[model samples]
Target: MTYTPPAPAIVDDIVSKTKFDANGLISAIAQDTKGVILMLAWMNADALRETLLTGRVCYWSRSRQSLWRKGETSGQQQHLIEARLDCDMDAVLMIVDQTGVACHTGRRSCFYHGVTPDGLRDTAQPEISTKELYGH
Candidate 1:
Protein backbone atom coordinates (compact mmCIF):
# COMPACT_ATOMS: atom_id res chain seq x y z
CA MET A 1 0.00 0.00 0.00
CA THR A 2 1.22 3.46 -0.85
CA TYR A 3 1.79 5.92 1.97
CA THR A 4 -0.43 8.89 2.58
CA PRO A 5 1.03 12.19 3.61
CA PRO A 6 0.77 13.06 7.25
CA ALA A 7 -1.00 16.20 8.34
CA PRO A 8 0.96 19.42 8.12
CA ALA A 9 1.09 19.58 11.88
CA ILE A 10 2.47 16.10 12.04
CA VAL A 11 5.01 16.92 9.40
CA ASP A 12 6.07 19.95 11.30
CA ASP A 13 6.37 17.91 14.43
CA ILE A 14 8.53 15.33 12.73
CA VAL A 15 10.76 17.86 11.07
CA SER A 16 11.21 19.65 14.31
CA LYS A 17 11.96 16.51 16.31
CA THR A 18 14.48 15.09 13.90
CA LYS A 19 18.13 15.63 14.63
CA PHE A 20 20.27 16.13 11.57
CA ASP A 21 23.99 15.66 11.74
CA ALA A 22 26.51 18.38 11.17
CA ASN A 23 26.16 17.65 7.47
CA GLY A 24 22.45 18.30 7.77
CA LEU A 25 21.68 14.73 6.91
CA ILE A 26 20.25 11.59 8.48
CA SER A 27 20.62 7.95 7.63
CA ALA A 28 17.63 6.36 5.93
CA ILE A 29 17.22 2.62 5.70
CA ALA A 30 14.78 1.28 3.13
CA GLN A 31 13.08 -2.03 3.67
CA ASP A 32 10.38 -3.98 1.91
CA THR A 33 6.94 -4.39 3.40
CA LYS A 34 7.87 -7.96 4.32
CA GLY A 35 10.65 -6.55 6.50
CA VAL A 36 13.46 -7.34 4.13
CA ILE A 37 16.10 -4.67 4.23
CA LEU A 38 16.71 -3.10 0.84
CA MET A 39 19.28 -0.37 1.04
CA LEU A 40 20.53 2.55 3.05
CA ALA A 41 20.90 6.14 1.92
CA TRP A 42 21.17 9.61 3.34
CA MET A 43 18.42 12.21 3.41
CA ASN A 44 18.46 15.87 4.07
CA ALA A 45 15.47 17.80 5.32
CA ASP A 46 14.36 18.56 1.78
CA ALA A 47 14.64 14.96 0.76
CA LEU A 48 12.67 13.85 3.78
CA ARG A 49 9.99 16.41 3.01
CA GLU A 50 9.81 15.34 -0.60
CA THR A 51 9.46 11.68 0.33
CA LEU A 52 6.69 12.43 2.80
CA LEU A 53 4.85 14.72 0.44
CA THR A 54 5.17 12.58 -2.67
CA GLY A 55 5.21 9.00 -1.27
CA ARG A 56 8.26 8.35 -3.38
CA VAL A 57 11.69 7.56 -1.99
CA CYS A 58 14.03 10.52 -2.40
CA TYR A 59 17.56 10.86 -1.03
CA TRP A 60 20.42 13.27 -0.70
CA SER A 61 23.33 12.33 -2.89
CA ARG A 62 26.52 13.43 -1.21
CA SER A 63 28.49 12.75 -4.33
CA ARG A 64 26.12 14.74 -6.51
CA GLN A 65 25.29 17.31 -3.85
CA SER A 66 21.66 17.18 -4.96
CA LEU A 67 18.40 15.35 -4.57
CA TRP A 68 18.32 11.85 -5.96
CA ARG A 69 14.88 10.57 -6.67
CA LYS A 70 14.83 6.82 -6.81
CA GLY A 71 13.88 5.37 -10.19
CA GLU A 72 14.13 8.73 -11.89
CA THR A 73 16.68 7.46 -14.38
CA SER A 74 16.32 3.73 -13.94
CA GLY A 75 12.81 2.24 -13.79
CA GLN A 76 13.38 0.95 -10.24
CA GLN A 77 11.21 3.20 -8.15
CA GLN A 78 10.50 2.75 -4.45
CA HIS A 79 6.97 3.58 -3.38
CA LEU A 80 6.78 4.43 0.29
CA ILE A 81 4.63 2.15 2.42
CA GLU A 82 5.57 3.67 5.76
CA ALA A 83 8.20 5.87 7.34
CA ARG A 84 9.44 5.67 10.89
CA LEU A 85 11.85 7.80 12.81
CA ASP A 86 14.23 6.08 15.19
CA CYS A 87 13.76 6.53 18.89
CA ASP A 88 16.71 8.87 18.96
CA MET A 89 15.20 10.81 16.06
CA ASP A 90 18.48 10.71 14.23
CA ALA A 91 17.60 8.20 11.54
CA VAL A 92 14.65 7.06 9.46
CA LEU A 93 13.35 3.68 8.41
CA MET A 94 11.40 3.54 5.19
CA ILE A 95 9.23 0.62 4.22
CA VAL A 96 8.48 0.54 0.53
CA ASP A 97 7.13 -1.32 -2.44
CA GLN A 98 10.14 -1.67 -4.61
CA THR A 99 9.81 -1.90 -8.38
CA GLY A 100 12.54 -3.70 -10.26
CA VAL A 101 15.82 -3.77 -8.32
CA ALA A 102 17.00 -1.71 -5.38
CA CYS A 103 20.72 -2.08 -5.81
CA HIS A 104 22.52 0.06 -8.36
CA THR A 105 24.24 -3.09 -9.53
CA GLY A 106 20.80 -4.48 -10.47
CA ARG A 107 20.55 -6.76 -7.47
CA ARG A 108 17.42 -7.05 -5.35
CA SER A 109 19.31 -5.35 -2.50
CA CYS A 110 22.56 -3.52 -1.95
CA PHE A 111 23.60 -5.97 0.76
CA TYR A 112 24.73 -8.73 -1.54
CA HIS A 113 28.08 -9.16 0.09
CA GLY A 114 28.56 -11.28 3.20
CA VAL A 115 31.63 -11.18 5.39
CA THR A 116 32.72 -14.50 6.76
CA PRO A 117 35.75 -15.66 8.68
CA ASP A 118 37.19 -16.63 5.33
CA GLY A 119 36.62 -13.26 3.75
CA LEU A 120 34.06 -11.12 1.97
CA ARG A 121 31.87 -13.18 -0.34
CA ASP A 122 29.22 -12.34 -2.87
CA THR A 123 25.90 -13.68 -1.60
CA ALA A 124 23.64 -12.65 -4.42
CA GLN A 125 24.15 -12.15 -8.13
CA PRO A 126 22.87 -9.22 -10.10
CA GLU A 127 19.57 -9.82 -11.82
CA ILE A 128 20.23 -7.21 -14.48
CA SER A 129 23.40 -5.75 -15.78
CA THR A 130 24.37 -2.34 -14.42
CA LYS A 131 25.40 -1.37 -17.92
CA GLU A 132 21.87 -2.01 -19.05
CA LEU A 133 20.28 -0.44 -16.02
CA TYR A 134 22.26 2.78 -16.46
CA GLY A 135 22.55 2.45 -20.21
CA HIS A 136 26.28 2.73 -19.92
Candidate 2:
Protein backbone atom coordinates (compact mmCIF):
# COMPACT_ATOMS: atom_id res chain seq x y z
CA MET A 1 0.00 0.00 0.00
CA THR A 2 2.50 2.60 1.09
CA TYR A 3 5.29 1.23 -1.01
CA THR A 4 4.75 0.34 -4.62
CA PRO A 5 7.87 -1.31 -5.90
CA PRO A 6 8.72 -1.65 -9.56
CA ALA A 7 6.09 -3.62 -11.43
CA PRO A 8 8.27 -6.36 -12.82
CA ALA A 9 9.68 -7.28 -9.42
CA ILE A 10 6.39 -7.11 -7.56
CA VAL A 11 4.54 -9.01 -10.22
CA ASP A 12 7.12 -11.69 -10.35
CA ASP A 13 7.15 -12.16 -6.62
CA ILE A 14 3.38 -12.18 -6.21
CA VAL A 15 2.64 -14.34 -9.21
CA SER A 16 5.15 -16.86 -8.13
CA LYS A 17 4.06 -16.93 -4.51
CA THR A 18 0.37 -16.14 -4.53
CA LYS A 19 -2.00 -19.03 -4.91
CA PHE A 20 -4.24 -18.18 -7.78
CA ASP A 21 -7.24 -20.21 -8.76
CA ALA A 22 -7.63 -21.68 -12.22
CA ASN A 23 -9.02 -18.38 -13.45
CA GLY A 24 -5.77 -16.45 -12.79
CA LEU A 25 -7.94 -13.65 -11.42
CA ILE A 26 -8.32 -12.21 -7.96
CA SER A 27 -11.42 -10.81 -6.35
CA ALA A 28 -11.08 -7.21 -5.25
CA ILE A 29 -13.36 -5.26 -2.97
CA ALA A 30 -13.31 -1.51 -2.78
CA GLN A 31 -13.89 0.18 0.53
CA ASP A 32 -13.79 3.66 1.91
CA THR A 33 -11.52 4.64 4.79
CA LYS A 34 -14.38 3.95 7.21
CA GLY A 35 -14.84 0.45 5.76
CA VAL A 36 -17.87 1.03 3.60
CA ILE A 37 -18.21 -1.35 0.72
CA LEU A 38 -18.10 0.75 -2.40
CA MET A 39 -17.88 -1.89 -5.08
CA LEU A 40 -16.23 -5.09 -6.18
CA ALA A 41 -14.19 -6.03 -9.18
CA TRP A 42 -11.45 -8.29 -10.46
CA MET A 43 -7.74 -7.55 -10.81
CA ASN A 44 -5.18 -9.16 -12.96
CA ALA A 45 -1.46 -8.46 -12.58
CA ASP A 46 -1.70 -5.71 -15.14
CA ALA A 47 -4.57 -4.08 -13.30
CA LEU A 48 -2.66 -4.29 -10.05
CA ARG A 49 0.36 -2.60 -11.55
CA GLU A 50 -1.81 0.08 -13.12
CA THR A 51 -3.55 0.79 -9.87
CA LEU A 52 -0.28 1.05 -8.01
CA LEU A 53 1.24 3.25 -10.64
CA THR A 54 -1.68 5.63 -10.88
CA GLY A 55 -2.91 5.47 -7.29
CA ARG A 56 -6.38 4.96 -8.68
CA VAL A 57 -8.71 2.02 -8.97
CA CYS A 58 -8.05 -0.18 -12.00
CA TYR A 59 -10.02 -3.30 -12.77
CA TRP A 60 -10.02 -5.91 -15.46
CA SER A 61 -13.02 -5.69 -17.73
CA ARG A 62 -13.74 -9.24 -18.81
CA SER A 63 -16.60 -8.08 -21.03
CA ARG A 64 -14.69 -5.17 -22.51
CA GLN A 65 -11.47 -7.09 -22.99
CA SER A 66 -9.45 -4.30 -21.43
CA LEU A 67 -8.57 -2.56 -18.22
CA TRP A 68 -11.19 -0.24 -16.77
CA ARG A 69 -9.94 2.78 -14.87
CA LYS A 70 -12.51 3.79 -12.35
CA GLY A 71 -13.87 7.31 -12.85
CA GLU A 72 -11.82 8.02 -15.96
CA THR A 73 -14.70 9.55 -17.87
CA SER A 74 -17.09 10.06 -15.00
CA GLY A 75 -14.68 12.08 -12.84
CA GLN A 76 -15.33 9.80 -9.90
CA GLN A 77 -11.74 8.80 -9.31
CA GLN A 78 -10.77 6.76 -6.26
CA HIS A 79 -7.48 7.82 -4.78
CA LEU A 80 -6.11 4.70 -3.22
CA ILE A 81 -5.20 4.75 0.42
CA GLU A 82 -4.09 1.15 0.57
CA ALA A 83 -4.33 -2.18 -1.22
CA ARG A 84 -4.35 -5.30 0.94
CA LEU A 85 -4.13 -8.88 -0.17
CA ASP A 86 -5.99 -11.42 1.88
CA CYS A 87 -4.12 -13.98 3.94
CA ASP A 88 -4.57 -16.54 1.20
CA MET A 89 -3.55 -13.96 -1.37
CA ASP A 90 -6.57 -14.80 -3.47
CA ALA A 91 -8.39 -11.54 -2.90
CA VAL A 92 -7.72 -7.85 -2.51
CA LEU A 93 -9.21 -5.10 -0.41
CA MET A 94 -8.77 -1.60 -1.75
CA ILE A 95 -9.05 1.24 0.72
CA VAL A 96 -9.46 4.52 -1.06
CA ASP A 97 -10.18 8.17 -0.60
CA GLN A 98 -12.78 8.80 -3.20
CA THR A 99 -13.40 11.97 -5.11
CA GLY A 100 -16.79 13.00 -6.42
CA VAL A 101 -19.25 10.11 -6.88
CA ALA A 102 -18.05 6.52 -7.01
CA CYS A 103 -21.00 5.19 -8.95
CA HIS A 104 -21.59 5.81 -12.62
CA THR A 105 -25.15 6.67 -11.70
CA GLY A 106 -23.85 9.58 -9.57
CA ARG A 107 -24.15 7.86 -6.22
CA ARG A 108 -21.51 7.80 -3.50
CA SER A 109 -21.20 4.04 -3.80
CA CYS A 110 -22.04 1.33 -6.32
CA PHE A 111 -23.77 -0.96 -3.79
CA TYR A 112 -27.08 0.81 -3.99
CA HIS A 113 -29.15 -2.24 -4.72
CA GLY A 114 -29.27 -4.53 -1.75
CA VAL A 115 -30.90 -7.67 -0.41
CA THR A 116 -32.27 -7.05 3.00
CA PRO A 117 -33.88 -9.44 5.47
CA ASP A 118 -37.18 -8.94 3.58
CA GLY A 119 -35.47 -9.95 0.34
CA LEU A 120 -34.37 -7.85 -2.61
CA ARG A 121 -34.76 -4.12 -2.41
CA ASP A 122 -33.94 -1.15 -4.57
CA THR A 123 -32.14 0.74 -1.87
CA ALA A 124 -31.44 3.83 -3.92
CA GLN A 125 -31.96 5.35 -7.35
CA PRO A 126 -29.57 7.04 -9.70
CA GLU A 127 -28.84 10.57 -8.66
CA ILE A 128 -27.53 11.57 -12.07
CA SER A 129 -27.48 10.33 -15.60
CA THR A 130 -24.93 8.02 -17.21
CA LYS A 131 -25.01 10.32 -20.22
CA GLU A 132 -23.95 13.21 -18.05
CA LEU A 133 -21.06 11.24 -16.61
CA TYR A 134 -19.91 9.62 -19.85
CA GLY A 135 -20.87 12.33 -22.30
CA HIS A 136 -22.49 10.20 -24.92
Candidate 3:
Protein backbone atom coordinates (compact mmCIF):
# COMPACT_ATOMS: atom_id res chain seq x y z
CA MET A 1 0.00 0.00 0.00
CA THR A 2 1.20 3.47 -0.85
CA TYR A 3 1.66 5.52 2.29
CA THR A 4 0.44 9.02 1.84
CA PRO A 5 1.60 11.26 4.64
CA PRO A 6 -1.14 11.93 7.13
CA ALA A 7 -2.22 15.45 7.92
CA PRO A 8 -5.20 17.11 9.50
CA ALA A 9 -7.72 16.45 6.79
CA ILE A 10 -10.63 18.84 6.65
CA VAL A 11 -12.95 16.24 8.17
CA ASP A 12 -10.41 15.45 10.86
CA ASP A 13 -11.38 18.58 12.74
CA ILE A 14 -14.88 17.24 13.21
CA VAL A 15 -13.75 13.74 13.99
CA SER A 16 -13.00 12.74 17.53
CA LYS A 17 -9.70 10.96 17.82
CA THR A 18 -9.56 7.60 19.51
CA LYS A 19 -8.92 7.48 23.23
CA PHE A 20 -6.34 5.28 24.92
CA ASP A 21 -9.08 3.15 26.45
CA ALA A 22 -8.28 1.05 29.50
CA ASN A 23 -4.81 0.10 28.23
CA GLY A 24 -2.29 2.84 27.68
CA LEU A 25 -0.74 1.03 24.75
CA ILE A 26 -0.60 2.26 21.18
CA SER A 27 1.42 0.81 18.35
CA ALA A 28 4.11 2.90 16.70
CA ILE A 29 6.13 2.21 13.58
CA ALA A 30 9.34 3.90 12.49
CA GLN A 31 9.77 4.28 8.77
CA ASP A 32 12.28 5.83 6.48
CA THR A 33 11.55 8.33 3.75
CA LYS A 34 11.98 5.52 1.27
CA GLY A 35 9.16 3.74 3.06
CA VAL A 36 11.34 1.22 4.76
CA ILE A 37 10.20 0.17 8.20
CA LEU A 38 12.87 0.44 10.86
CA MET A 39 11.27 -0.53 14.11
CA LEU A 40 8.05 -0.81 16.07
CA ALA A 41 7.29 0.41 19.56
CA TRP A 42 4.48 1.20 21.93
CA MET A 43 3.44 4.61 23.16
CA ASN A 44 1.04 6.04 25.64
CA ALA A 45 -0.42 9.50 25.13
CA ASP A 46 2.34 10.95 27.28
CA ALA A 47 4.93 9.37 25.06
CA LEU A 48 3.14 10.73 22.03
CA ARG A 49 3.05 14.19 23.57
CA GLU A 50 6.69 13.97 24.52
CA THR A 51 7.62 12.87 21.00
CA LEU A 52 5.85 15.88 19.58
CA LEU A 53 7.27 18.31 22.11
CA THR A 54 10.84 17.01 22.05
CA GLY A 55 11.06 15.87 18.40
CA ARG A 56 12.42 12.61 19.71
CA VAL A 57 10.75 9.23 19.63
CA CYS A 58 9.46 8.24 23.05
CA TYR A 59 7.98 4.81 23.71
CA TRP A 60 6.24 3.11 26.60
CA SER A 61 8.25 -0.01 27.23
CA ARG A 62 6.23 -2.91 28.59
CA SER A 63 9.42 -4.59 29.75
CA ARG A 64 11.03 -1.53 31.28
CA GLN A 65 7.71 -0.26 32.63
CA SER A 66 8.69 3.30 31.75
CA LEU A 67 9.28 5.59 28.85
CA TRP A 68 12.11 4.47 26.65
CA ARG A 69 13.71 7.40 24.89
CA LYS A 70 14.88 6.24 21.50
CA GLY A 71 18.63 6.37 21.25
CA GLU A 72 18.96 7.73 24.79
CA THR A 73 21.97 5.55 25.46
CA SER A 74 22.85 4.24 21.98
CA GLY A 75 23.05 7.61 20.23
CA GLN A 76 21.03 6.12 17.38
CA GLN A 77 18.39 8.73 17.99
CA GLN A 78 15.37 9.08 15.78
CA HIS A 79 14.72 12.71 15.07
CA LEU A 80 11.01 12.93 14.48
CA ILE A 81 10.57 14.38 11.02
CA GLU A 82 6.91 13.47 10.87
CA ALA A 83 4.21 11.61 12.75
CA ARG A 84 1.10 9.92 11.37
CA LEU A 85 -1.83 8.06 12.79
CA ASP A 86 -3.46 5.10 11.14
CA CYS A 87 -7.01 5.43 9.88
CA ASP A 88 -8.25 3.74 13.04
CA MET A 89 -6.07 5.98 15.20
CA ASP A 90 -4.86 2.96 17.09
CA ALA A 91 -1.38 3.02 15.59
CA VAL A 92 1.28 5.59 14.76
CA LEU A 93 3.99 5.86 12.17
CA MET A 94 7.04 8.06 12.51
CA ILE A 95 9.24 9.38 9.77
CA VAL A 96 12.63 10.22 11.15
CA ASP A 97 16.15 11.33 10.43
CA GLN A 98 17.72 8.31 12.01
CA THR A 99 21.33 8.35 13.16
CA GLY A 100 23.79 5.51 13.72
CA VAL A 101 22.03 2.26 14.56
CA ALA A 102 18.44 2.01 15.78
CA CYS A 103 18.59 -1.48 17.18
CA HIS A 104 19.97 -2.71 20.51
CA THR A 105 21.55 -5.60 18.66
CA GLY A 106 23.99 -3.15 17.02
CA ARG A 107 22.21 -3.02 13.68
CA ARG A 108 21.28 0.05 11.69
CA SER A 109 17.65 -0.96 12.18
CA CYS A 110 15.77 -3.48 14.25
CA PHE A 111 15.00 -5.24 11.00
CA TYR A 112 18.64 -5.90 10.31
CA HIS A 113 18.56 -9.59 11.10
CA GLY A 114 16.15 -11.44 8.91
CA VAL A 115 15.07 -14.96 8.09
CA THR A 116 17.28 -16.75 5.64
CA PRO A 117 17.69 -20.21 4.21
CA ASP A 118 20.24 -20.83 6.94
CA GLY A 119 17.83 -19.81 9.64
CA LEU A 120 18.85 -16.55 11.34
CA ARG A 121 22.01 -14.57 10.86
CA ASP A 122 23.48 -11.25 11.83
CA THR A 123 23.05 -9.58 8.46
CA ALA A 124 24.15 -6.21 9.80
CA GLN A 125 26.00 -4.68 12.71
CA PRO A 126 26.19 -1.12 13.93
CA GLU A 127 29.17 1.01 13.00
CA ILE A 128 29.82 1.25 16.73
CA SER A 129 28.97 -1.13 19.52
CA THR A 130 26.45 -0.45 22.30
CA LYS A 131 29.06 -1.27 24.88
CA GLU A 132 31.28 1.31 23.25
CA LEU A 133 28.65 3.90 23.99
CA TYR A 134 27.78 2.82 27.53
CA GLY A 135 31.06 1.16 28.48
CA HIS A 136 30.71 -2.55 29.20
Q: Pick the candidate with the highest lDDT.
A: 1
Cα lDDT, all candidates = 0.93, 0.78, 0.74
At residue 131, candidate 1 shows an lDDT of: 90
Better of 1 and 3 by TM-score: 1
Model 3: pairs clashing at backbone N, Cα or C within 3 Å = 106-126
**Candidate 1 accuracy as TM-score:** 0.96
Give stretches of model 2 more than 4 Å off. 1-12
Clashes (candidate 1): 0
Q: What would the TM-scores of all predictions be?
A: 0.96, 0.82, 0.78
User: Candidate 3: what lDDT?
Assistant: 0.74
Pitting candidate 1 against candidate 2, the one with the higher TM-score is 1
The regions of model 3 sitting more than 4 angstroms off are 1-16, 19-22
Q: By the TM-score metric, which is better: model 2 or model 3? A: 2
lDDT per residue as tens, model 1, 40-101: 99999989988988899999999999999999998899999999999999999999999989
Tell me each candidate's RMSD, in Å, in order: 1.0, 2.6, 5.0
When 1 and 2 are scored with lDDT, the better candidate is: 1
